[model samples]
Target chain A: MQSARADAAARLADMGLPGRRDEYWRWTNPAPFMAEAVPEAGAFRADTPIFADMPKVRLVFTDGVFDAAASDDPRLAGVEIARLADAPQWAGAFYGSLEASGQAPVRRPFAALNTARASDGVMLRVTGRAARPVHISYRQSSDTSEAILHHCVKLEEGAELTLLETGTAAARANLVLEVDVGAGARFHHIRPQGRSHGHRVYSAIFARISAGALFKSFTLSMNGRLTRNEAMIEIVGDNALAHIAGAALGDGADGDFHHDDTVFITHGAEGGESRQVFKKVLRHGATGIFQGKILVQPGAQKTDGYQISQALMLDDLCQFLAKPELEIYADDVKCSHGSTTGAIDETALFYLRSRGVPREEAVSLLVLSFLADAIAEIDDEAIAAEILARLQDWLARHRG
Target chain B: MLEIKNLHVKLQEEEKVILKGVNLHVGAGQVHAIMGPNGSGKSTLSYVLSGREGYEVTAGSATLLGQDLLALDPEERAAAGLFLAFQYPVEIPGVGNMVFLRTALNAQRKARNEPEVSAGEFLKLVREKAKTLKIDAEMLKRPVNVGFSGGEKKRNEILQMAVLEPRMCVLDETDSGLDVDAMKLVADGVNALRDAGRSFLVITHYQRLLDHIAPDVVHIMADGRIIRTGGPDLALEVEKNGYADLLAGVL
Candidate 1:
């Protein structure tokens, strides 16, 4: 475990920190993150925290430190959970493996910095279907706290698990989640992030899927100043599926909102499938960016990959930038990538207004419809409904 | 109880005029048909009445139940008991049919200071109205007009009309793309909503739709103006002789 941390530190030192000149960080400025001291952010106490009523194994993190008294016991059927400081051997072996393997083709410097510095996270080992979801609630209590957290999950063959993460971590947050899906296993992850005032988030997810395994993750982001979310996934086993989707609503009242989604998925085995769907709604000079790629390795025949990123700009002041790429090294593969930046459909708006819906209400409805594709990725009915309600609330609060 | 006196309109993007001195009077419990040639400003009247943007109402006055129709916004017009069944219903993907219907219904009710219906009541009303148009549950569950066939789109329009229950309805060439059976279904849906307090202005190019809905009066329009006004016999004459004769007669 120590050696793995050392190697991650060395990797971070080699890559150094990303600058504006870096090809991957060209669209998103890295100046705020590169500052010697983390920027100060105000602490926000959520009035009604997300997933508060859900039945689950709750883990509470206050200002990047675990709060055992505020959390439910970390015990569930068919699962073993431990903090990173007391990680089991199985988790220690696979902790940095996925994150390291994902570094190739594109360098993720923030993820490396997280792996090298993170000391607060949960390690989960699932050998069978978990009784319920594991909900991680990140509650920030200190206004100037900077959090670096890393989580590793190992799912044994034929096992199943669902992970739900919500709320902001600290004034500034750097989170790395590494997942290993075993053969025939299933993993579902849903995260609703960042309602804190002007908080910045840089998060990454690195996952590997084995034969016949299923891995799906979705994110819903709102009310964040600067957010950069990256995901690197690999399908190393035949006939596996990996899906990742996100929906972000950004309203820069004074031109402070910026959100970016960067993703790379690799297909390394025959009959592998992957999908990346992301949608962002920006208004009032907010900026949205998307950089996604699908790579099919040699001998990875019969791979199916799809990627789409779309932005709905409410006003001419808003900005949207996208770069979609697909590199195929094998024959007999099906892959498609599309990126679109457009304004609201005037025809649709007129149709709604003609049907008696007010302009504001109609715009909100259309915005929700635009995000429906990405939100549809969540299979859980209750969770999806919760996300929809939160989105409606946000739209109502930030009316035009 | 709808009146339009010397209504003139032109495109906002260009200087081309569309409707010139259009005069229409639709009384309560009456169904009037406006039969005209292509570009005769048949659809333009419907759009202008519904307050669609990109139209400059140069000189006109339209009143619905003695209220200024031209003064309100599009949504305000809708809430004031006016509905237009589009010739080409816009496809709105990801907005579920049921949800859209409920939202429109509730919005109108709210605007009119009436209590909004509960979800159960809305669902029941929608299902009952949709069944008449032969719109199955699956179609209602899908997005509004998305992936719908031509007939299905027409039927969806009628379903919306039935659900909203407006006082004055305008059908702008609703029979453009429909087979006989589908047309019958749509016509049946429209007829079921007919009441003494509700009136309709059925716009079409042929007498075929009038055969189903059976308008009380038919007006022949040509060159942005109504050329002739008569009973149902006038529509048959134009359908038989074609709009060229009507256009010639107007000239």
Candidate 2:
């Protein structure tokens, strides 16, 4: 007899890949995406350790299983971090829905695969409130070759957590993170997807914000061969707010990056607001794509949702495709989406150059200014400064 | 301090010349006012002298402090102690006035190999200058020339010149958009920065501003060249009888 997970995986295999004809995957074609075969079993390493400076609570997962002895973070009190085998009830409720809906209608074949093989991922629950949020770092290096999927965080009522996740790998890796924010809870998730020359990563973050909860997400994508990040967020509660911001810089041949953000402001959720801003700069024949949709259901009045996507192409060979869509079913709601693609301002460039600033420095300053609004949204000034420095470094190396 | 020997220039890509064989000389301890009717190339002369770029110097030579002025870039000319107070200043968004002023000042200083001034010291220096100019403290924190009134923008140009402290300053009708009170404030700020080692070329369409700054020499320009030269009284004569008599006398 086949297990439920096995049955779902077989069903996904029968469906095959999702193609361009699929409505959701219309802009970004994930059917032809290259995927590594799933291994039968894998184990975590106890000797090799990472994230030494953080609050000491680091969970290392190899393939899809947790390493108990290697994971030691005492501050994880008032919260539970367990595997599917340990918490079958919680897993049944969460994974059961995902398993039942695995083959529903998602356009991406990878997302179906994720749901089918959704074992070994962590389920973090902060009941009532927690002392400090756990910091989960997904470190996928060359040693662990199997596809990595292990971090899933959820904050219950009145809970608060700050998650810093990094996708550090030299080989092909697929990471999926699912976060559920309960009523009045706050979640700050930061993902810095570092890139390798020959690596390809597809990461999907599925989050649902309950009533009065806040979700703030920041993503920085750099040095990826072909990286696609998707965030499907649902505002299931009334008066909820979500702010999502991301910045990406692509360089190198065949360096393709794609981002698809689908937000659903459900009906009866009055005073719900969603704001998303994504900025990208393509260089050296690199390609970037952004498809954002804000769906306001019926009775979702007073829902203010705004999205803007801007790109700066350094070379004529560079390409960018930006599609911003707004579907409003409710009246008396303010929703707008705008997209623009152009090169740097030559007049402003000349103005700066006439002031004795070198052409390169002038362009860099302007680019920094262009990305400043996104960077400024970060509450931590130190983190903001670090991101800005990294952005400047990338410009200095690739732009010159 | 500045000399132009038969300088000829044409506005961007134009076949016709604007400043044709215009000669002007200004030494330290001197203020030269060039009054001309419309279409006399007064603004073109300022743009060409400051190396604003896009102008074709068909034939001419301009030297500042014995260095080829036209050969240098705009910032280079500025670092060489040449300043042009524009008739219409540009509004640079997202750049605070103090930040822009400090960056420009530090860039010039760095070019000279001088140590950069501390932020505290720079603020102190700017605050003192702003008080004398009657500029509000809050204005320094706002973006440069963004949403500034006409008089306020003109005052900002003068404030910049004062901070830059160039050896020779060219005022291109800085008095055009200013009221009487604002005009007096602008003139007072320029006069306070005046020194024996610095020269100024004030370009105006009326003798109203001359009554305040009191130019040392006034030259009447017609068509594209200077037709007559005289003391400060020439501005009054032109104001009383208009450029009609002045052009007739020159012809």
Best by lDDT: 1
Top candidate by DockQ: 1
- Number of the top-ranking candidate, with TM-score as the measure: 1
Q: List runs of model 1 lying over 4 Å from the truth.
A: A44-47
The lDDT of each candidate is 0.91, 0.72
Candidate 2 CAPRI grade: acceptable
**What is the RMSD, in Å, between candidate 2 and the native fold over all Cα?**
5.4
**How far in Å is the alpha carbon of A372 misplaced in model 1?**
1.0
Clashing pairs in 1: none
Per-residue lDDT tens digits of candidate 1, residues B1-251? 89999989999999999999999999999999999888889999999999999999999899999999999999999999999999999988778898888899999999999999999998898889888788899999999999999999999999999989899999999999899998898899889988899999999977998889988989988888998999999988887888787677568
Q: Tell me the TM-score of candidate 2's A chain.
A: 0.84
Docking class of 1: high
lDDT of 2 by residue, A109-129 (tens): 566576666556667776755
Second chain TM-score, each model: 0.98, 0.97
**lDDT value, residue A135 of candidate 2:** 50
True contacts kept of 2: 0.14
